[model samples]
Every structure is written in C-alpha cells, then in structure tokens.
Target chain A: MISIPIGEWFDALINWLKDTFPAFFGAVGTVIDWCISLFETVLSWPHPWVMILVFTGLAWAACGLKKYGLALFSLVGFSLIMGMGLWSHTMHTLALVLASTLLALLIGIPVGIYAGRSEMGERIVRPILDFMQTMPAFVYLIPAVMLFSLGKVPGAIATVIFAMPPCVRLTTLGLRQVPHDVLEASDAFGATPLQQLVKVQLPMALPSILAGVNQTIMLALSMVVIAAMIGAGGLGGQVLRGITQLRIDIGFEGGIAIVILAMYLDRVTHALGSRSARKQ
Target chain B: MSDDQTVIEARGLYKIFGSRVAEAREMVDAGHSRAEILKKTGATTAVVNSSFRIAKRETFVIMGLSGSGKSTLLRLLNRLIEPTYGEILIDGEDISQLGPSALREIRRRKYSMVFQNFGLLPHRDVTENVGFGLEIHNVDESTRRKKSLEAIQVVGLEGYENSPVQSLSGGMQQRVGLARALATDPEILLMDEAFSALDPLIRTQMQDELIELQSRLHKTVVFITHDLDEALKLGDRIVIMKDGIIDQIDTPEGILTNPATEYVATFVENVDRSKVLTAGSVMHRTPALATHKDGPHQAVRTMQHEDLSSLFVVNQNREYVGLVRIDDAIAESKKGGRSLDPILQRDVPTVALSTSLRDMIPLAGSTALPIPVLKEDGVLAGIVTRAALLSALSKESGET
Candidate 1:
C-alpha cells in the first residue's frame, strides 16, 4: 500500500530532469539562437535564386544523384505552392526545423558522449528519456506556454525535446557498442582514456551516432504539430486551424505538406549518416 | 639478465579472480588441489606465480591452449588488467605500479597491440584509423596524416586509405590493424592471436608479413598463439604455459627435442619432428679420422650437411673414400672401395630439383640413401630420412 503524493512526485520529476540533463547546452542554446537569427536575416535577402542554388548544392553534396534531384524538384514545387498561397509560413517552418535540429545535435552528441563514458550518467538519464519519449505531445506544450509562452521559441523547444532522444540514445549506444578488443588495443597502443574516446571510440561509433541524429530529426518533425498548440504557425498550425475551423481542404493540404517535408528530411539525414559511415 | 637489458620482466605474477583470492591461495598452498581450493574459496587463478624475461627486439611467443592464460599473461604486460600480486617491469621500470596517466603515456609511447579480430575503427578509413594513436598524442593534424599515410604504405594498403574498414576483407582489415599499430612506431608490439581469425592461406601470408616486418623494423614483439606450428615458425624463444603455470620456456628446437615435462612432451610428440629438428640437431660430431675424402658430390654433400647420415667411409690412413651411402654404409665401410651409387659418385645431385632431402625417409630392406625412384605414380617423390621412416612406422603401430 504505497500512496505517492502528487506534489512530492512533481518535485521529484523536476529534480530528476535537472540531474539528467547537461548544464552546458543551456549556455550553448543562447549562442545558437543568436546565430540562427543572423542566418535567417541573411536568408531573407530579395534574390531567392542564390539561396536556392546554395541549398541545392548542399543537398547534392550530402545525398548525391537521385535523392538530390528529387529534393530539388520538391523544393521548387514547395516554393510554387507557397507562392500560390501567398504566405511566408513555409519558409518560417523550414527555418525552424533547420535551427532546432542543429541545436539538438549540438546538445545531444556531447551529452551522449558523457553518458557513454559514465555508467552512472546513463543510469540517471535513460529513464527520464523513456518518460519524455512516452509522454503525450501536448504535455510539452504546457511548459512551452509557461516558459517561452507561444511563438517560434515554443515550437523550437517542443521540437528539441521530441527530436532529442534518438541523438542521445544512439550516441550512447554507439559509444557503448565499440568493441572491447578495440579499447584494449588502444590501451596497449599507449592511448590515454581521453585519447581513446576521441580517436578510437567516437570515430568508430559515428555511423550509429548519425543514425540517432536522423531519428532525432524525424521525432522533432512529429513535434511540429504539438508546437502548433502554442500558436506556432507552420503547416502544422495551418492543419490545426483547418481542424478547429472545420476546413477539410486546408487541413488535407497541410497534412500533404508535412508528409513531403518529413520524407525529404529523412532521406537527406539518412544518406548523410551512411556517407560518413562509408568514409570511415 | 640485468634490469637494463631485460625489456620485459614479470615477478610473482598472480592473477586471482573472486573476492577471497588470498584465502584461496593459502588453502591451495596448504595442500589443496586447485578444484578443491576453488570450490572452498570461490577463486580462480589465471596467472599463477609466473616469472619471465624477454630481450629487446626478440620475437617471444607465448603458446598455450584456450584457457591456459597466455592472453591473460600478454594483457598483464601492458597493465590492461591489474594483477592480484606481481611486478611487471618494462625497461627496468615497474609498469604495474604506474598511475593511470603515466600508464597511458607509457602505452602511447612504448607499446601497441594487435587483436585477432583486427580491431580497426569501423567509422575511420585506413589513414584515419592508422592516425588515431598519433592524434591522441596531440600530434599536428598534418603530421599525423603524413605518418599514417606512411604506415598504410608499410602495411601495403596505400590505395585503401579512404576505404572504410568494413568494406575490406578479413586479410585487408588485418593489414589496417597492423598499420594502425605501426603508425605510432612504438617500442613494442603485442599481438594476441592476430592471425587466428584468418583462413589458413591468409594466416601463412600474415606470418610471412610479420617475419618480413620484424626483419625490417626490429621491433620487440610478444606473439600469442594456440598453434604450435606458428610458435615454432616464429618464436625466437617460446614460453609454453599450461593451466596458469609455465611448463617450459625454450627455443622451438629445444622444446621439440628436449621437452621439460610430460605435459610439454604430449604437445611435442604429434609434431613432425623432422621439420622442427635442424641439421645441427642429429649431426654426429666426430674427430676427422677419414682423410682423402671423395670429391664432394651433392649426394655426399647432403649427408655431410645433415646430422643423421648413413656413414662416413675412410681408408686405413684415415683418407676419405666416397662417403658411404645411407643404407649400404655398414656393408660398404667394411668392404672398402666398392662405389655405392655409380651415378652419384659420377655427378653432384642438386637439392633444388628434388624436394628437401630432409623430408624423405628410408624404407626397411631398401638401400640406405632411399634413392628416390620416379614412380608409376609418374612423379618423383623426394628422398625420405631414416627418422621419417621410423616415425611413420611407429605412428602406424600406435594406431593399430
């Protein structure tokens, strides 16, 4: 007969989160946000063709041939549709996705490395992640409301939480799964523990870590809808508005847009991950 | 040997598992069998009071079965696992007593290990994998890159620098591992069953590569293997371990010819003694009573070089007659000047055309030199030794 008090439980949950997460990322996030604002300003220049060319080239470099071609077509089509709708919401969503995923990687990878190296860190953090992953999407919207209180920041926060798990889990798993023999060999080769982790373990674990990044991106995309609850306007907000106002056509179109974006991100990130694996 | 000359020295090495290792050792010393002691005290000893020294630049092999602690012994050399009780001195310094940082510095600068699994980093291409150890020492990126490229060439993987390790075959991956070790150019190389995972042909190739590398690099190596043939082929001196104890430590020739104990003898018995036993081993050294020796032909040349030859015939004044052929030596030595092989006395026999004369054996009732007759089998089987013949017959009898 164990009766747990709700207030005590809530306090425990907060304490658990504080203990689990890395403190460095909070500082890193501020700098990253400023950088994102600068990048957005530059991207907003009137000549759209130059930006399109650069993005296409980046896609070509990362994914190569067939995927790059498909991505190019999708980008052109998306631009045409946005032109017809006469809205900049699509561009805003694109910026949000890019900023959030980059931030997720920056925060997730180092924390993953720490968790991988320390058993205690892994034990402390893993259960909290399990809770984060399983919790309803709307639950995060409340914290987004309380803290950032609606807009792009709330959307980004929701995306970060949702997309973060894979990066952490994959990084930890990849580092942990590095062969015992390799570690022994590094030790015998006169490599210090730090050297072994940076040179031996991390490099070997890259493919898997990249896979985690891809998963994190997908999870972050799922949270795009949840972010709309906090009035973050994107395709997800369009869909939410369509549902609330009972406009079937608008909702259906927004759903299609979401699908297109998800597919593009998945292919690009997956290709990037495997490309690194092959280079290694 | 003095401390300076001894590259590796272990004293009172005791690797005891489980909490009550001390109590277990005490019980075992007080007249308990290892099994009884283990049951009573819940401890297992992997290295039991072992001690040895390896000279610099020597190829020292530790040979043992799967559970005999050969790998454990090798691991202890680099302090991968701390010994329950021991001192491991590398170049006169006790490595076992060093701190983690100092131990790491020693590992970075002094030694490198190769594993059977070819533990190349999967995420790194050949050059990157090779450069990893150098990178750890905070070497400049460009220097590490150039050195790693050089190491890749050394292991014959020049074109594979950008190839992922997983894309390579087992043999190629093994080369990457070797290159990774070589990149650091450390003082010692510890190989623990480095070729055991490969196919037989690849194993042989890797062994040859090692021999060639050792000749060039002259790096001190501690090679571990379960295969006696590999041990014989490679070891400058072999340490044969059995059940956590060193059974014998000797040159391959010494171990095969004069095994130290019954355990070692069991291993030596099944081995092809002819291949391992050198010409100097069975050769009978004698005062030169025979003079005026027949012009040394290849037939006589072969007998003269080998230890277990038929006989050396001579005149009363101790002058040499054409050497007595292997089989008819007793009869020919007594009869005086009756040319044994009219053909052999006429011409020198080249060992190159015939397979190793050392490989052949004489059959009972056959003329001693076992004149290798070309066959209805239409092939010329090289001459066999008396030792080979006896061993074959003995094997047959034992089987029956």
Candidate 2:
C-alpha cells in the first residue's frame, strides 16, 4: 500500500517554522540564553567551599539539623564533588535546571490555574499536556535545535519542554481538588472571585503546586545529560566526553556527581512540599 | 408583622438544574410533574415556585428530606444559587437582577452563611478563620481582629484562637464557622444544615446555643434542616418542601395542630408535641384576675363569676403578684381586709411564655392553681390550666 511520508512532512514543518518565525525564535533564544548565563555566573562565581557551606546550611534549615542527616550528607557530597574537580560543571547543570524550572513555573502555574478554573481551558490544554508528557524526551531536542540552534540555551529550552508537563498538570489537579464546600463557603461569605482564588484556593493548593515544582526540578535534572548532546556544557558534557573517548573513570565520576546533585535537589524540594503540606 | 419588618421576601422563586432551564420552567409553570419533566428534557427542578417572607429577627426554617430543595431555596435567598425565574427582595431591593459587585456588597454587609460541614479554611487558625469574612471585606486589621475575637468569645471559642481548624473537633470547627459568620455582623444569616454534621448531643447543644445567640443578636436567620425536631425547635415559622415545591409555611404550633397537607402531616407525625407546643400556645386567657387593690369581696365575686376556686391577683400594671383562694377570700372578707394582697398566696406556679408544654407538664401536675404564663417583662400574658395542658398533650396521642 502507498503511504504518506510522515518524516518528510515533519521536516518540512520545522523548516517552515524556522523560515517564517526567525525573529520570534531568535528573541526567545536570546532571552533563554541570558537567563541561563545569569544563573550559571552566579552559581559558579562562589568558591567551591563557599558553595558547599551555603547549600549545606540551606539543607540544614529545610530538613532539620542533626536529626534528619540530610544536612550532613549534603556537606559530604558537596565536598566530594569539589575533590573530584567537577564543581564548575555541577554548577552549570544546577543553573540550567534552575533557569528552566523558573521559566516553566512562570508560564505553567498561570496556565494551570486557567485550566483549573475553566472546563474549556482544561479541555484545550489537556491533550497538549498529554502530548508533551508522553512524547519521547529526546524528540524535544529536535525542535529545540531547530528553534534555538545548538547551545546551553537550546538545551535549557528542551529541558523546559520535557519538565513542564508535571508542573502544569499537578497545579491544575491541586486547584481542581480544593474542596467544593470550602469554595462554596467562600462564595457565601461574599468573597470576590479574585479574593477566593488568592485567599482560599491558592493556599489550599500550595502543597500540590510545590509537589509539581519538585517533579519539575527532578525532570530538569534528568534532562541534563541528554542536553549534553546539544553542546550544553555541564557534568553532562563530561559524561559525553567520557563516552566518546572511552574513559570509564570520567563517565563514572560524572554519573556519581549527577546522582549526588539529584539526591540533594530531590530531598530539599521534597522537604519544601512537606513543610507546606503540614501548614495546610 | 408589617412590610417594613419583612427582612427577606422571595416571590415565585424557581431553580431548575439542567441545560434547558427555560423550557423546563415553562413546563413546570404548565403543571408538568418533576419526574415527567426530567424524563422529557433531562431537567431537574431544584426549587419550584416557592414564596415566603422572613420577618426581622425571625428564625425562618426551610425543611425537607434530601433532594427536597430546602438548601437550594436557602441559597436562592442570598443569590448563591441564581433563581431560574423569580425575584428576591432583601429589604425591598430585588436581588435577582443585582450585578455581581452589588450582590457582593449585600453579602458583605447584609447576609452571611454557615455551612453544614463547618467549612473553615483548613490552612487558617481559628481566629483567622473567624476573621476571614472581615478580611474579605477589607476591614481594617485591628478592628477585624477585635471583632473576630469578640465573635470567637460569643461562640465560646476564646482559647482556640491560634489553634489550627484541622486540630479542632467537629463541634469546635462549627463554632469557628459560627464565629466567622457572626464576625461579619451581617443582618441576615443563612444557615444550611449548620448543626447536622455534629454528633446528636453536640447538635442539640449547638442548636440551643444558636437559639440563644439569635435571641441576643436579633439577626434574621434562615435555617435549613431535614430534622423535623430541629425545625420545630428553632423556627419561628417553617416552610416544608417536597419535590422542589413548598407544602406549607406555618408556625410550629400551627403545623402541629393543623398540618396543611398530608405530606406535612406525615413529616410532623412523629414529633413529640409536648416538646414543641409551648405554654403560650396551650395557655388560656387568665380565668379570673384581681388587682392588688381589689377588696376580698371583689376577689370572691371575680372567682365566683368565673366559676373558679381561686383567682390570680396582679398589680395595676398587670404584673402577676399572687393568687387568692376562695376560702382565703372569704376569711379575708370576714376579717375585713381592704386589699386581696394580704390574703393572696404568693407561692403560685408561674411560667414564662416560651416554656415548653413538656416542661410545664410536671408543674401542671403538681399545682392546684392554674399555671400563670408570664411575658418577658413579668406581665400576666395568660394562664395554663391542668385541663389545657392535658388536652395539648392528648392531641398527639389521640390522633394516632
């Protein structure tokens, strides 16, 4: 049987977007590059010991001091990364994750709230979110490369696309799950729609939104190594270098560093979610 | 009593739930059955052509089984549920056509509601929950705090101000809800099954507390409940609903004595009439009352004229003082007493107008003199005799 060539059609569509929206694409790339570099500069500027001190202090404050053990573990992990000479690369990965996470939140939360409030908005956004989540993570880099070209910006852009679904989906779920009686009570007490959203719905949904943020951060971290292929310099690049040059020691160090960073971010963000959950 | 005294008036209110509301309303107006309309156009009428007026400071109750639309009708008054076709006048203003901001203003200044589940914001502490209404209205912070504290005290939740609502028991949470509504100082309160979620003992306590609060606050209340006893206890006048339609609107005594429909009769069938019928309802006009200045001869004439063995004696202001027996009057006459007050028995049984017949039953059984029903100011409003008490009690058992 004769068949239409889907791959050719996809390529033609990407080419058309690149041709037709060059200025739009360029502006987006510049903005993303600026954000990523700003975070990268700030994160890497401090001496490795200073960075370690700051992160350990934050972990101590968030997860508790002597009792939880996360703070002590973070201190040891950071010291090991510094000893391994992967401090700068680890900072770059963190910067990329932070930048993408911030951007995703800025866009995703408001969209999620809109979807939560309106059935039409939900219906329109649900399929798109499903596609974004279900599509192969690598496929995001294809569009990222076409739009922003190869660099940390494209890598960060791809990470945002791959990580944003959970942020939006969970935010929508949290807001939708606010108890109906509470909303009704707010209405009964003469709360304006804006007042209800700010005072009642948002506070109640805060824990869930934080959970979404946690997932977004974790997803962004997972994308770092994949982003390395697009010339995003980080620990991901070290892993890529180790692979291409057949250096098992380099690959193993890079893998260990990623694991350490992942554990730290996951614990900190999970602690934040739990704190808010307890408050609720 | 007067149009000015009517705090809330609903005229031809209807709430039909479905997409084809207009058609459904038309069918309803044309006398189609609720089930038939549902079958035909997938429409459910929540409140059907209900009309009632709540007087100032009156505890108006709307009652029905689940799906009877009593809650919907309560929401209709505050425009929480938009009526399909009707007008609601809150102090002579038609709220049905009010814009959102205007309606919000009314909600802020005039109407507040308490929910069945004690819908306190789980994140807020008790004080914050109580002050939420004031905060929503943008009241000044200090004043909001003070008023909320006062409301909290009013609901007997003084020490729980900083306690999280989730940490509170069901009764305490409901107190927070009550305090929240009370903090607003709104003119009207719409309570949707406000005590139903509490345990039976707590529910009774809350009901009594609410009645006491209403007496002091004088806020017009529209209470919704499925419990008939609750309706009879709290309602100054009650509207019983069935299948989205009002079956009757009457005082508790009127409903008990003359239920307008079989549905309402059945609803009130199991009610302990003695608990509901009050002293004022069962009392007779004072049989023979003598002023303190009346001579013993006059007391005797009054007792003989009314064919009574004794006579109640009141002062010139009609405040009850004592009772004079026939033998005492004759003895006083023989001794030439100028006033019946010297011969009158001061230890007569007396009850306030609001005392329930159930409570007065024992007093009636113990007393030989007719039970004098006093007004709040101690005036002799009426007297309850043993015969009247027995008849009121007998009506319930006799009917069955």
Candidate 3:
C-alpha cells in the first residue's frame, strides 16, 4: 500500500481532533459544575469529619476493628492535609467520581446483557468496547469538551467514557460463564427464557458483575482527576493549581485526599459485594 | 391382569435429531431399517419407533445404560422434547397435538419430573425451592408453604426447610428434589436416574422411602435407572432399552426368568432373584387333615405355629381336606376371624424332584408353601425354605 504523506496524515488527525474537541470540553464543564453543586450540597450539611467517623464505624462492623482504625486514621490525616490547602475542592473531586461511576453502571449493564445473549451483538460491540477501554483518558476530554463546553459536565463525560468499559466487559463475562447445566435445570422446570435470564442468570452472575462495577468506580475516580484540565473544580484542580504555581503543599494535600477517597469507596463497595455473595 | 386399565399410550413414537426427522421416521416406518433410514435422511435416532402403555399406579421403570436414550424416552412422555412422529395419549386423550399453553397446563397439573442432579435452585432456601413449582402455578404463599412443609416431612427432611440448598449434602439435595416433585401432588411422577447419583447405601434408603411414598400416594411413576437391582426392587414392570430400542418390557420376575435377548440376559445374570421371591414357592398341593375340628384359619394358625404352609383344613370327621395358605390364615386372624379367601389344594404350588428353585422362588409371596420335599407317594414329608433353592442354584451356577 502506498504510504500517506506525513503532512496529510497530520492534517487529518488535527481535523478529527478539532471536530471532537468542543463536545469533549463541553462534557468536562458540565461534570465540573455538577461536582461543585454536589460538594455545596454536602457542605451545607454535617461536617466531613462526622461523616468520616460514621463510615469508619461501618467499616469496623464490616471488616473488623483493625481495618476500621487504619481507615479512620487515614481519613483524618488526609482530610487535615487537604483542609490546609483547599478543603472544598477535595470534596468536589469525591462527588465527581461517585456521580460518574453511578452513571457508568446505569448505561453499562443493559448493554452487557444484550451483548452476552446474542453472538452477533457481541461481535458488533466488542471492537468498539475495546477501543473505548484502551483509548487514553486525556483523549476522552476532547470529545467531552466538544459536546458540553469547558466545565464539570465535560469532565464527568470524559470520566464516564474512561470508566464504563470494565462494567460492560465484566457483565458480559459473568453472563457467558453461567453454568449450562444450571440453565438447563431452569429450562426443565418450564421457566421461560426471560424468567431464566432475570431470575437465574443475573443472580448467579452478580458476583462477577459486581467486580466489574468495582473496577469501573476505580477507573472513574482516576479519570475525573485527569479531567481537571477542562475547568473541573476538585482536588484535581488544587493539584493542577499547585503544579502551575509550584506550590508543593497544595499538590501533596490534593494527592493524599484522592488516596483517602479511593480507599473509602473501595472498602465500602467490596464489603457490599462479599455480603451479597454470602446471602441466599 | 388383562382387566387393568392403561393410563398412558404412545404409538410409533420417533424422536429423530436432525433437519429431516419427519422424513426419517416415514422412511423407517415404511419398511426401511434404522441404518437405511439414517443413510437416506442423515438424522440421528433418539427414540426409534418405540411404543408402550403404562397402566394407572404402575411403577414402570425404563432401564438402560448411558446414551441408550431412556432419558430421551422419558422426556418424550412429558413432551419436554417433542417427538418427530407419533401420538401420545394420557387417559385416552391425544396430548401430542396440544399447544404450548395447553401443554404447560398438562405439566402443571398432570405430571412432574425429578432430575438426576437434584435441580434445586442454589440461591433459594429449601422451602422456597420446594414451593417454586407451586408458586409458578400461582398457588397462594400460605397454602404452598403449608403443603411444602408436609412434603418436606414426608421426605424426612423436616428441619432443613430454611437452609440454602447449596449447603445441603447430595442425598439431602435429592430428597429436596423429591419433596419439590411431591409438593405438587401431580398424577404422574417421572424420575430420570433420581437415585443413581447417591451412594449405594443412600440409594437403597431412598429406594425404600420411594416405595413407601408410592404405597401411600399411588402416583403413577416412571423411574429410569441403569441398575438392574433397583429396577427389580422398584419397578412393577420394567422396560429395558438398548440404543434407543426397547429390548424387553416385563415384570422383574418375568424379565429375570425369561430375558428377551442376550443383552437382557447379561443384565440379569448378576441379580439374586431369590431375595425377591417369597415362601409360597413350594407348598403341598393336597394337605393331610388333622384330628382337630376347625376351618382354614384354624388350620393355618395350627400350621403357622409349626412354620408350615400346607396343613390340614378339615372338619370333625378328621378326613383329608384342602390346603390352607399361612398368609390367608394370618389375614383372617387380623380381621378378627373374618373369612378371607382361603388356599385350596388346587391353588397351592408344588415343585417335584425335577423342578428347580429358580422357577419356584418367585411364588414365595403367593399362597403356595415353601418348596415341598416330596416322598414318592406325593405326601408332604418336609418343606424346603426358599433359601434352600437359592443355595442350590448358587451351587449349581458356582456363585456360592
């Protein structure tokens, strides 16, 4: 095949990026505004320390005292450090991750069920799924900004793009791995296909699908930090401000807050997953 | 036996698995053999032109080695899988042409099946699993639970109602499966190797429990198993299959004594048929009368006291009279000396010097005495235990 001219290829790339940029920026801006509003709502209520203590108590009940103590200490220390720099931004970042992850789950699961049941659907969707998963987090901001303009919305859109793949992939995997004998048993009982899918297949596949949800949450948390460039105000903005102004204290505080938030969400979700798995 | 009503009938049933199942069945029924049909239609046969009728409350067992298509045959009866050709009639009504809704109605009310693997849902507790069918049929929860609890008690699993099925042992899980089937109280119970997965001891226990349950419920059962012993023990009549074709269909005694083919003979060879036969195998045809004045019950009581089947049923004259069966004597006593059908001299079974216990052992449960050791004058010198014939056969066959 004849090679395309380097200048032509570069121009095509630039054109494509320019076309997608506004949607990308726009999604980021919308997400950032939502995050700021969520933080304001949370701030208008009880203190962060009180909520942290309640969560620590829950963790103690779920995972025992040692984990609870460690989690509490980490939360307090991380919050104090972030407080010295920008307290509200850290809370906004936590809200951004939570909101984006919830949105990813809503969209991912039904699509996964569709892909799992039909071979043609899986064949058609898998390549697109692969592309979404492997595309750089920074690259997602381009399309988000193009659609939603520069704000929290663009950031949330980019975070969702970056995070949703795991949920879809895991749900598909779980459904595919459901035991054939178990399916046959349901069929033998005169269960219609829909009843079998809803009652038998989904419940059996819940553990694996939950694992997907956990992964998506973590991925969204990381990507929302990257979305700070599109005027998304959060701990990510603090870290970005620290980098631009060369303020070491602000960067360290923001980074520590993100770690604390990640640990809290992960522990809570995992505990729920295991608890569900243990139930009849 | 001829007066017994038939409850289920299948005519020229064919379950051919391929694109041209209809054509294949036509070709086979039109004088072409299985091989010839296969060559023409390229369809694999599952139940090849098989047909049988099950009488009401009959424990009909389908015995076959794995892949012989006994399971396929059972599914065909309930229409779990449709047959390519044939008509199935339940109580003289053709059910093969029933639509999905009608078929579902039939299944919900008329038939239930127990799977080999004990198909209790893992996520549901025992009570829920047992009541699942009842729930699907729209039985109210309170009624279903009450019925399910009774079924659980019937299966001897009373305390395990709330336990998740995954936590139960294999035999317990199987009992739950049985309870689920029994909970519905359908007219027919179809078991597909239901006991074969259990340990031998557990299998025997389940078999005994099943017999007891059948005795009480009198549900028409079609049990499928590869074990000949199980078939003999549980089946009122057994149908043995080989490669989708039925090789034999008869009572255990009928099949054991007269195997239809070599394949069936091989299956029966290891069976200890003597255990199944009863003490009535060898009674004296003509009993000598005693000096005591009495009827058949009194004669039987007198004889049973001495462990004999053929004793005198006589009047005050002390002349020789008819023989009395010990069983009939016992029956009369149980009924407060009420008259029961007594064993006559003609009704009793007798084996001569040339006879084998292999033939006589089956009559042990009947009115005949234990095998009688006869004198040349045909007088009852002594009686042989059913065990004696078995030992003799064992010695002759070098199986002792």
CA displacement after TM-score superposition, residue A166 of candidate 1 (Å):
1.1
List model 2 lDDT by residue over A155-254, tens digit each. Answer: 9988888899899999999999998889998898889999999999999999999999999999999997899999998999999999999999999999
Instruction: Arrange candidates by DockQ, descending.
Output: 2, 1, 3
lDDT of 3 by residue, A1-280 (tens): 9986976775577567767675764464555566557755775356767755665666667665555664666567556744675556666777778778878888898888888888997998799899998877787787566556687777888888789988998899888987764665555555666777887789878887898898998898888778999987788888888899999987877887787777777876787677667874
Tens digit per residue, CA lDDT, model 1, A1-280: 9987986776676556545653643444456557556655665554455555655566677787756675576567556545546235555566677788888898889889989989999998899889878987777776555454457676787788878888999999999999888887777776767778877888879899989988987877778776877776777788898899999988877777777667767777787998887676
Residue B375 of model 1, lDDT score:
26
Worst 10-residue stretch by lDDT in candidate 1 chain A?
A: A80-89
What's the candidate order when arranged by decreasing lDDT? Answer: 2, 3, 1
Q: What is the C-alpha lDDT of each candidate?
A: 0.74, 0.91, 0.76
Which candidate has the highest lDDT of all? 2
Query: For this target, which candidate reaches the highest TM-score against the unseen true structure?
Result: 2
Model 1 stretches astray by more than 4 angstroms = A1-3, A7-57, A65-68, A84-86, B1-4, B27-42, B123-132, B137-168, B215-217, B286-400
TM-score of each: 0.79, 0.94, 0.76
User: Candidate 2 falls in which docking quality class?
Assistant: medium
Separate clash counts for every candidate: 18, 0, 49
TM-score of predicted structure 2? 0.94
Q: In what order do the candidates fall by TM-score, top score first?
A: 2, 1, 3
